[model samples]
Target chain A: MTSSTTEPIKITSKEQAEWFLNQYDTFLFDCDGVLWLGTHLLPRTKEILNYLTELGKKLIFVTNNSTKSRLTYTKKFASFGINVTEDQIFTSGYASAVYVRDFLKLQPGKDKIWIFGEAGIGEELATMGFESLGGIDTRLDEPFDATTSPFLQNGLDDDVKCVIAGLDTKVNYHRLAITLQYLRKTESVHFVGTNVDSTFPQKGMILPGAGSMVESIATSSGRRPSYCGKPNANMLNTIISAKNLERSKCCMVGDRLNTDMKFGVEGKLGGTLLVLSGIETEERALEINEAYPRPKYYIDTLGDIFDLTH
Target chain B: MTSSTTEPIKITSKEQAEWFLNQYDTFLFDCDGVLWLGTHLLPRTKEILNYLTELGKKLIFVTNNSTKSRLTYTKKFASFGINVTEDQIFTSGYASAVYVRDFLKLQPGKDKIWIFGEAGIGEELATMGFESLGGIDTRLDEPFDATTSPFLQNGLDDDVKCVIAGLDTKVNYHRLAITLQYLRKTESVHFVGTNVDSTFPQKGMILPGAGSMVESIATSSGRRPSYCGKPNANMLNTIISAKNLERSKCCMVGDRLNTDMKFGVEGKLGGTLLVLSGIETEERALEINEAYPRPKYYIDTLGDIFDLTH
Candidate 1:
């Protein structure tokens, strides 16, 4: 829950929209719902971004999606006719690698990292100069047999220092089996998750997110992962240190209440703006409950910022 | 924690063992850690069962493993030279079917039971004369693509009244995707889990259990399933009603503290006997903690009953 005493202010006038834009020097945007949904860009996304850029507001795209690396996100932005560098993209996959390198401080080559996710997380780890395994390996896709499975019979690598889990679409008994073995191998081996989001809206439906995969491994291993995604203090701190931005000059805009709004509010940023283009509804945002987050401001969409200016 | 105020009593002498046996008319036993570990039976299992039969104590094997049906359990029992009727077995699979049939009371031919588990759950539902889908379906084994997956594109059957989840070693994204869709489709569609044991000791390694699968779906769906296995009131109620047994004259013998001991203690059975032959240790059982269950009685192993008398 956010520590806000007052209800979120709705920006309906041109004056309020201008004041909101002028209030922050840097703006952190959540992708998927705010910038685009699935493949189609949200209404007037390009216009809103151009307006922010023209105002000289530093923009950073922070997404909890751990399925893609920063390079892949750069490609996605290119496909949408938006120009963004890898440095401007902060994905949960990248956050996991940063958390391991900066926070855990595992020795790169000597400490092998095991993954229970797609190639995105592995690619991020590789970018950090760490040797990793168990991501997108066809050998792990084989059917599991309790008695005959090699994962159960053969011991895991002792050099494996950490295990990171995210959205593993190729989730099978074998992958989970080896991951559990590493998690339970020793108390020293670290466990990390990209995010804990239960579900995310994609296309016309809500789909299972990385949280499902992380929770499954956590359950079987009787251990909780150090989540490095949105709302987690580590992610905010990492971005703040890397970008060298002032906390009071940064604002977060997102469509999710728990992850995005909570992330901004808990981090004590300049402000948080909620949009109705994604999972959350206006009614839900207005409710005053300890379990629900209260953003500083609300709008119909990210496009509303520029639209109201006219 | 159990309602008992005192610590568990340890049986050491032949006199104590005989008196403990005389106190109960029936005994409910947990199969995995108590009867056998993998395919190998514990010390003097057959002799102890023979002794119980000679004393005219009704024996029931209650296992939380939903992977095997009653018929499959009968075969496993025969393999161990233990003669037990299908009536004497109460697997979590059978309990799930019982909960759906006797408790939910969904119309047999009209309502469908969607399964996210193995063939055992389907077999149990079939035995109860209910039509079920989505168990051991080879079509579910194919790789998942968000846009191209048939499970995502094709709408689920409206006739689905309930979704039952158990330990599915064949767990994949496609199976979970469909299950999430059904869980979020409508409030009327029920979600049920066979058990919630995080891990089970198997082949000298702790492996993921039904709880892992149940938890993954529960997470993605953002809904909790009504668990029908150990420590759940529904399982004890079903067994009590079906067996026509006296609650004050029955004892539960198990090796795991959470599932087995908690099941017996919370059910308010006459007594519970903890054995060190499985997942629990004497040290863990003896420690006093609010979260830890305290059984009424404990011994080194079930075979101690016959050995002490001799």
Candidate 2:
């Protein structure tokens, strides 16, 4: 853990940047606001990535948005004229699949997960040899029959040992009911939410994200799902476990304080860099939850490091 | 308002029961647990009611379950071979309608409310000359077109100034999406939840109640809804406003601590009574939340009052 008693310092000087660069070999970058907003790439981020790559630094893209899989994110990176492989992306969905397979210790082929998300979550779990039930377009088409008590009705997939919730545009009552049924009817089923990011920054505007989806199941069921996203630091740990990286030689770079900064701080990485390119302004950063971990450093943008390169 | 320095006293004697019964001429009872378990009536409850009637005590039935309207509840009483008037019953649906009409101060026929519940909530709102939108049996039959964003398609009701949520068996993504759209997409829209009762006791088993139904909209919308059910004290206040009853002369009697006991306690009624005939067992009563209102007295059951009357 980063046992630093010191507060986050402003990374303004070249010497500070040089010292920071020398400390970490692996860098995790938060996409959306930090890298690009929607289709438009942020200024100097490409140059920064190229500079880091030239130095032979390991780069990983992390996002809480589970709507898109690594494959889709790869295309998203390419759309912005940035080169990022699917392997370099660590999504909440991917983390969730890993969590289910590893942490929960559910057998991939035998123990199934009822998914209240899109193909992104499904794809990741599938890649891990796990079957995902009722995802995206696979909505519950069961007609409401007043004559039948759905709880009393049999034929529900008894194999489902987990319910993983994510942002599903096609979320409906039947899906929620089925999920609740899995949680209620079944014994000892694990409830997982990919991330509870209440909103997502996209194209200069914030939109409702995964937290909304998780809220319903939690409220109705009177049960909170174990979240697998930023602020939890599971994503960084997952990367570390997979790649066997030096924990003390890694840094997390992001725009948001609550998730990204908290993730990095809790991970006890070499450093956490907060960029003001997204949701949290410098003024807003002053008022943070006392419980949350603070970033090690704050900068105006990822491009601010250009001064260091100069 | 029950300014008692004394903790809840056990009603173990006739003198204690006499002091309790004599304190409140107006007794509000929670239906499902206090009176009967679904279709089956509890032992000696009818006799206790008969004795209370002999003493000419004013009995009012209050419930947070918005699934059944006062008219439906009247029939439920009739099914139990009990005498009850529609006026004597106050359901969350009735409370919600009253709240919207009197509390929210929304102009009827001008400001509309989108209903995310059953016919009970709809009928109650209708009684108040208010228009209700979606409800039970009103499924969003629209097929998910992956190519299109549901929010972009026009045809959503725009005049809706409020979204009232309750125990909607027909709760689906479209309903939740519409609720979220109103809360997030619309401007200054009111969000109201009928109640947040997590579970309802039925014959031999407990099932998820309206609270579970409300959980989704609250979670997904990222906005907390104003509730009009038991423990909120609004139901009691609504009754007080309509009937102009003496608040000090009233007491709430039920099986649950969170809802029924809290209702009476917060209402500043004479006292609250807990009976061990329903959801909560005597052992569970020992672990009352310090934040919640406590009952003034406890007994084996509502039927246990027979010993006092005798």
Candidate 3:
């Protein structure tokens, strides 16, 4: 049942950091739980990044949270004292837009878009040269607010060729109804979702995320959206191409077993590290092994990486 | 979109009835929605039966409703003025017992059971000459009461080998919790459910059925139950063997598309006629062509069978 050759290690001090050096050529770090949660940075996170840079290791910040764009995440990381460029950040939102652009091969100025997400997703679509029709405040001027309105009452015009879902704070019955209507009318309309996470941690409580909205639309439309995020090959391809890293030399590290561990397994990365700081509990790890891929190393914290010998 | 040829037939009442007599050699009828709903028989039901008998067609009553035994259904049919022998009726409950007996090949006196259904399912198991335990009364101590009493709570011991579900008025959280616990501990414990339907018509309102209970146990146990009903080959085999009818000559007539039409399609019967008097609507008939083995004919009502030939 054990899939790894590396023995489990326990960490105590900074001197053991040499053990993890040169283990991986390209390191993919998850943003939300690994480096920082919301506005606060985890302890020693900056020092670890500085150390990784000093060693000339390749680093890419991969995040499934598509609520914010790369620019937003870049600014947030800079605020936390981790200086990173926009090109170094990859969001599920960016992956989804790139997937749609390449898959459809939309002619310039010919593609019409309908989006149900925040500014982050809109920016990604715009960067890919796709026109976005809706955003956070795009529907505020209508007689009834389409953004917050019920699905049955909202008027989603037929011009919308693609319906993209990322994250929306005002996701309600009206938004769902309009989305469903557009989906039904245009059977060929491409349905794409940023991720399939049911909930995300916010202020110590779990809030409904993109997966819930995807479920509603999928059930009504009898169509499963093409998810572009960790565990999905599209996102992994985007990351590999962007980093110019060989699949055999890259490693994905995260706290969630399904997303993070799956990325390593599906992308054929060198290794996967499951940190116990968030999401995947010990009990969940056992159950997830029944279906999902297992991580190469299980550690109490990301700091435990220091205990491993390259 | 149309799959079948609409050969319009303007037939007299006599020719219409004769067309049915000539076309069908073996008539398999579903009990609940077609023949009688609960206690009341539909109009002209008796005449239809008399006419079919006079035409010398072999008849078999098949039902997925495992709430009642063949004897109970036979008795109910007799009260409705359609005389039928116990051998003429077939139930999924009885078929499930047969499946366990022949397929699993359990030794007659050695098997211990945990049942989660009504009297019919228990009686069927007993008739099959298998040792049975755990009926509605055995679990709840009182009929139709879901609340667990002290006396009933003690019966949920660890030794139970099988969990069978049909329809139990006393099905509740306490019984479900115990059953789930047993299922989890003894992963080898066989779990069987009558069907996966959520609601059934009762007193002019849709009442929760065995499907919800089956779903609860499935969610907790993380195992799909072995089903014995229409669309499942086990039930179809039982009916064909009981009546000694060639599978090719028999026609399964019912209202629902998934269950009734599925039997016709799977069994490769003479014809699958979808009567619009029950579960599936006219719009559904159009969509059904998208699935395998579409229905032979779509009629407004079962009574229209009397108008099939010119």
Question: Global lDDT of each model?
Answer: 0.89, 0.78, 0.68
Q: Is candidate 1 or candidate 3 better by TM-score?
A: 1
Model 1, residue pairs in steric clash: none
TM-score of each: 0.95, 0.78, 0.54
What TM-score does chain B alone reach in each candidate, compared with the true chain B?
0.97, 0.90, 0.85
- Candidate 2 local Cα displacement, residue B44, angstroms: 8.1
Candidate 1 displacement at residue B211 in angstroms: 1.4
In the order shown, the candidates' DockQ scores are 0.77, 0.35, 0.03
Off by over 4 Å in 3: A1-16, A37-40, A78-81, A116-119, A133-159, A166-173, A181-187, A198-216, A246-249, A281-290, A304-310, B1-14, B17-256, B259-297, B300-310
Q: Compare the candidates by TM-score and give the number of the best one.
A: 1
A220: Cα error in model 1, Å: 2.0
Model 3, global lDDT:
0.68
- When candidate 3 is compared with the true two-chain complex, its DockQ is 0.03
The TM-score, computed over Cα atoms with residue i paired to residue i, of candidate 3 is 0.54
| DockQ pick, better of 2 and 3 | 2
Question: What is the C-alpha lDDT profile of model 1 across B182-257, one tens digit per residue?
Answer: 8999989999999998887777878898999899999998899999999898889989999999988999999977
Indicate whether candidate 1 or candidate 3 has the larger lDDT: 1
Which digits, one per residue and each the tens of the lDDT, describe model 2 over residues B139-193?
Answer: 4535423224354356556777788888766555556555666777665888888
| Model 1: per-residue Cα lDDT over A113-140, one tens digit each | 9999988898888888999988887878
Which regions of candidate 1 are displaced past 4 Å?
A1-3, A146-154, B1-7, B145-154
Worst 10 residues of 2 chain B by lDDT: B143-152
Q: Is candidate 1 or candidate 2 better by DockQ?
A: 1
